[model samples]
Every structure is written in structure tokens, then in C-alpha cells.
Target: MKKEKGLQKATDFSGIKTIDDLHQHLKTNPDDADELGEHFITKLNNAYAEKNKTESDYEDLLVALDEWEEKPEAASKIRNTTYEANYLIIGACIHNHIVNNICFPGVTAIQRETGLSRTTIYRHLKLDDFRPYDKLIRGKHELMAKRALEHLYYIGVVDRNAGALKTFIELTGFSKKSSASNINNYIQINNLKITREELDQLPKEITEQIAELISEGLQAKDCDKKMEDMTT
Candidate 1:
């Protein structure tokens, strides 16, 4: 994870009023300001990375801070104290990370982790400025698809006779039409030696059934067993 070059140089912080304001103040005014600034920036960058936030999100936060400056009430609420400011910044970073990057199976998982009521989470999500859940879910699916495709490629390279699509379906336990679409897209995009004909040869009914088992929360092994039973 490379640090953004823009953040390396100290930015004007007189107007911005957030936990980051204190961070910038300390970095530029202290006797060992250079060292302290570097240290603080490193920790801040690490927090962003830990939350799986991209550089774009960091830029968004900066913009949000700028917007906050215009709202005196919000600006006044920002913590100036070092310890409290650090804590709040870290918390917000984690929350942002989860909202933008994590794909929770349900609201309960989110509630357990954030200690926020499901209603509050939903309300925040409804705000246009908040992270887009749909995009996050799509991103998660794309990642899973990529990994599955890579595995298929490896198996194909190692053993030409291996049933890569069937193996991938079994391994990922992804039976949905979307999952199938992702796999097909990856196959086409990479122009991998594997053929659509090969994938199409697998029984569509079994694939769809596997997806149904997945939606029912069946484990991969159980789904495999169900698939086997269906075939035999």
C-alpha cells in the first residue's frame, strides 16, 4: 500500500476542523514537529489501510473535513485533545472501512461489530454521502470471482483433464446466476485457454441447485454431498 504523495506535504489546516486538525497542528508547531508529523501521518495512513480504504476514500474524508469547517457547530464538536481525537479518528476510519469494504452477511453481523442498532446503520446508509452498499457487494463478488477463476486457471494448467468449472463451483459453493456470469466474464476477459464449451458442458440444473443450497446457508461440503446425491 503506497502512501499518497499529496498527504506527504503538510496541508493548510486552519479552516479544517476535525480530529485531523489537531494532527496537523501538532505536526507543524512542535519542536520535533517533523518527526512527530511523520509519525502521526504514518499512523493515520495505517488506519486507513487497516480499514481497507482506498486513496479515493481518503480524499473524500479530506473533502468532508473541508465541508465541516463551514458548519460551526460540527467544527466545534471536533475533539482537539490528542488522545480523544486519535480514538475518534480510528473509530471513524474503522466504520468507514467496514461500510465501504466489508460485506456482512446480515445486519446482525454489523450490529455486533459496531455496537450500533440495525436501524441506525440503515439510516446512515440511506444518506447519499455514506458508503454505497451495492457497490461494495459487487466488489466483493468480483473479488470472489477473480479468486475462483485463478484457481480454475491453475488447475487447468496443472491437469488438462480436470473439470475446472465443476471444481470451481464446488470450491466456491456459488450457484447463483450472478456467480456464473462473473465466471463467464473472467473467462472471456482473460482469454484463458479454457473454453465456454467446457464450462457449458456441466449440468446447468446441478449448478443452479448448488446455488439454491448456498442461499439456504448450506456449507460447501454439504452442498457437494447434495450435488453428488442429485447426480447418483
Candidate 2:
């Protein structure tokens, strides 16, 4: 407790590296065991805390790497921590949802799959620029309707491959020559052409994941019923 009274060298020294190092220090210093026990415990606790952070960070990094391999275009995001990786994965989920569906999957759906906090997911969504699917804005913003145009392209209505479409007014109700030109710009910028699929359909992996979530929910319900019976 009295830091100033202790040996200056001992106090100034770097942290105890390992259990063996602590034992060596105790042997050479001949400190009181009861007094030194708390110090060693603190050091060990610090080591454990660092281990948890580094371990989780490595795991998140691996997941991020896998995602980057699949969608190499997103590798430009420059992330270096578990926190950043969480954002990256959430962004991927949002992008995938846009590619696969009419609207972004809600935060809870993303949470069920990613196990990230709602706040983290929401923060990533806030930085989203590709579309308004993840946003709360009610109406279509004409100049910024990239996702809508891409959806049309996928469905063969606004054919990017043929360089064809109905007028922007007939297709989207709001006429903008800029929207059509922007679609071409988007195709050039992202170098992507989404395969056509029914809007109601989900990818095979997502379908399996939904089934697993349902099974887990049913198991949790059974556990709750048993707990209620025990209380009664």
C-alpha cells in the first residue's frame, strides 16, 4: 500500500513476466508471502486479461480475413483491431443483405448471426454509404438510389449488360438521367454484376443458419419450461 516506502528498483521494475519469474523474484527478495501474494495475483490477473483480449482479437482477425478472401473489394477498409473487425463483419452482413434482398436485415438478425453488440452493429450501419436499406429514411432519394438500380440490373429490367432499361420514371417513379448514369458509374466502380435470384430467396448458408437459430430457440423454451416446473 505504501509505494514510496518500498524498494525503488522493485517498484520501478517491469511487470512480472510469468509464474516462474515471480517465484524467482520472491526467492531472491525474501518478501513476506502474505504481502507478496496479492502482488502476484494482480500480475497474473493482468496477464489473463491481456490473454483474453489478444485471443479474441486473433479470432476476429481470422474471420475478417476469411470475409476479405470472399469479397476482396472490401479489403480497402484498413482495420487493425477486434473492434474494427466487428465493424467490417457487420458491413459485410449489410452488403450481403442488399445483394440478396430488398431491405437490410434488422439489427437483431445480424446479432443472431454475428454475436456482436447491437450498438456495434448500429454504429457500422450509421457509416453505411451504399444504400438506404439499413437507414430509417422513408422515401427514395433519387440521385442516391444505387441499390435500387443494382436490384433492377440483377432482375434484367434495367439491363446493365445490354446497356438498356425502361426510363427512370417508369422504372423508379422518379425520373433522373443522373440515376441511370450513376448505375453505369457504379458498375464501373465496383466491377460487379449480381446474379439474379428471387427476392424472397435466401442463400443456402443463411437458410441453414436460420434453421439452427430456430432449434436453439426451441431448446431454450424447453429449458425455461423445466425451470418453471421446478419452481412450482
Candidate 3:
């Protein structure tokens, strides 16, 4: 594991895009999650030794690890990778599925559906499973999945995935042209203070221009002006 710490530090290269590049870099360094966990254990031992603190905390951590190893589910999860990294991959899978298939579900829904703890899901979305150390302390993963969806939305890959099931919040507003005839029908049906006789008394050209404007999404004022000029 100590060897892994060296590998982790040495392999961190910036500006690399795509997973293949990452795989190549990692292959050269060859560090795994076991090494990462062992490295953290060593650090914890050093800190406790320096402070001359009670070893009970370290002992408890050891016991926790032992228990986790015995648990079939946890053991399988951490088989070839670190607990954190595996958790991250799971979260990404969950996120992709939710966005692509089911409507964007909130954290509660995600938790209920995936049966993963909220903390783990948050950590995956926010800090990529707390790899770099500082991120673990920063509390950045709070609502991380939600933030990722928002990023996707701004990029136009996904629409509003919230508020109503099966209905995305429309940014373009109601279709004015599509509804104009319905609106006119409603106004006519209501018969508020005006009668068919009054509508009939209006000039035929004015009525025709109003109909055209309503159907074509043109402003009534512009339609009226155009009709008047045509007559002149």
C-alpha cells in the first residue's frame, strides 16, 4: 500500500481527457484501492502516534475493516478497487440511468431506488469518491448529483428533469399560434358583454385582418395598420 501512495502521487497528471488516457497512466503507475486504504491507515497510525492519543480509535478502525471484510456485500464491492472509487463508479452508473431512462429523481428517490446511502451517492457525484484527500474535508458533494444534472441541462443534453413527472418545464412558453384559435373560441363562448351582432357589425376587412393576425402570430396593431394601408 505504501508503494501505492508513491504511485498515486506520481500518476496525477492534469489535462488528460478520456478514460483510455487515464487507464494508460494508471497502468504505468499500477496503484489500486487496497493500497489507498492501507496508505490512509498508515497516516492514521502516524497521526495517533505523534499526538500520543489513545489507540482505541485506530483499533476500532481495524475492527470496522475486519467486519466490512466479513460482510459479503461489502467484500464484493471492494474486491479489486478501493471502497471510494467503486462507490463512485456505481453512482455514475446510477446517474446515467436516471437521466436517460427514469425522469430525474431527487436524492430521496435515488436512495430509495439504488439502496445506497445518501452520503455515498453525494460523495461520488461531488468528489469522485474523495480521491485527492482535500475534497473529503471540503463537503463539496452535498447535492452533487443534482448539480451534475443542472450542468447537463445547461449544455442542452437534458431538459428540466424535475417538477412534474413526464412533463419538462418548457422554456419557449405556451404555443401562442396553436392556442390563438382556442382562445378566440373561449372568448366567443363566454359571450362577455359582446354579442354576435356586434362582431358582425365590425368591418369585414378589420375582422379578416384580426383573424389573420391571430392565426399567424402577428400583432393585432401591425395587422390593422397593414390592412388600413392596403385599403388606402
Candidate 4:
């Protein structure tokens, strides 16, 4: 009987031969940068698969990459033509934790690993830009805020009487004044439960005074009744 053939495994381009070869390949196949990025991601996943990489490792990488990218020598090496190479470097840097900036490497570490100067790495980072990745982070914070607000509403932590503006301020770390202004605008735009008039009626000073009094052990029921009478 004929011997059965084994399945062929994908070729690992991980062992790139030379810098020139890498430059040429990236120059020739610009679109392939995305594929190279995926390859780098796979490499990272495999590397961290067995042992969990610490937060410091990821942070160090970001700092290293940040420093490396600013070098003039780095820019001149990849200058103008190799989008694939640029994308590959960035993809590797931000692979698993795109939303987490801590995953980025510092310049010295990146240089040590890639054998490239800081400038070259810097150029690569700026090539396609990481703004889209940054947006992912901002989007995450926004989602969290939304969920927190939903929870507050569900558990009666916030209600028509106790507006979500305070919770939004606490969760978002925005100042009470700014948070109120922003929440007012948001409520107006979305036509949410709170109205502009209601928000305007309770000035920041009065709300703060009420909060202070409540914190001082004043009866909340009496305070609420007083606030209602004052507003009316």
C-alpha cells in the first residue's frame, strides 16, 4: 500500500534572512503588510501562549517603540516606499491589546529586538498612524460609561429626581461643572429622560450645597422636600 501523505504546514517567514531582504519584500508587496501584521500577531500569541506576559513587558515595549520611532536613522531606512514593513511593525506592537496602550514597547527594547534604529521604527509607526487604535480605547471608555449609567438606573442609584449627571461625572472623572454641561448637551441631543429646563433649574451651587448637607447627616427626605419646595 502507498504511504499516506502528511498535511503541509504553512511556511514560517518568521526567520527573515536579512534586512535588505525584508526591505525588498515589503517594498514589492505593499498590501502584504497586513498579512505580515497577522503573522506577527500569531507570533506574539504563541510567545505568550505558555507563559503569561506581565503588564510591565507590554508597557516596556510601548515605551521602547515610542523612543525608537523618533530617530532620524530609522526614518531614512524605510523612507517613503515600504508600507508593508511599516504596517508589520505597528501590527506587532499593538497586536493583541490594540485598545491598551500599555502593550506598546519602548525604543531601546524595540531596537534591541528588531536591530533597527529608533528613527526607522518611528517612521513606521507614523506611516499608517495609530489614531484608529486610539479611537478603540475611547470607544471602550464610552461603552463602560453607558453600562454604568444603565446599572445606576436599574438599581435606583439614579432616577428622575437623582439625575445621572452625577454618576456620569464620577465614572468619567470629569468635573461636576463640565459633566453637567456635557450631560445637558447630551440629553438635549438624544432627548433623554432629563430636560434642559430641569437641569438649568438646579444650579451647580445649590446641588453642591444639598450634597454637602446630606453628607453631614441631614435627613435626605427632608432635604428632598425642601429642594422641591425651593424649586417650585
Identify the superior model by TM-score, candidate 1 or candidate 2: 1
Clashes of 1: 1
TM-score, structure 1 vs. true: 0.26
Candidate 4, superposed: residue stretches over 4 Å from native: 1-14, 17-21, 27-41, 51-134, 153-176, 179-232
Q: Which candidate is the best by lDDT?
A: 4
Off by over 4 Å in 2: 1-80, 128-232
- Candidate 3: segments with Cα more than 4 A from true spot: 1-80, 92-96, 99-103, 133-232
lDDT by residue for model 4 (81-179), tens? 233443455467556344555556666666555544455556555745533334334556789877877676444332333344345434543333445
Of candidates 4 and 3, the better by lDDT: 4
- Alpha-carbon lDDT, every model: 0.46, 0.46, 0.44, 0.47
Candidate 2: Cα lDDT at 167: 30
What's every prediction's RMSD, in angstroms? 16.4, 22.1, 20.1, 13.7
Which pairs of residues collide in model 1? 175-211
The TM-scores of all predictions, comma-separated, are 0.26, 0.22, 0.21, 0.31
Tens digits of lDDT, candidate 1, 175-210? 334345454432332545534455556687754554
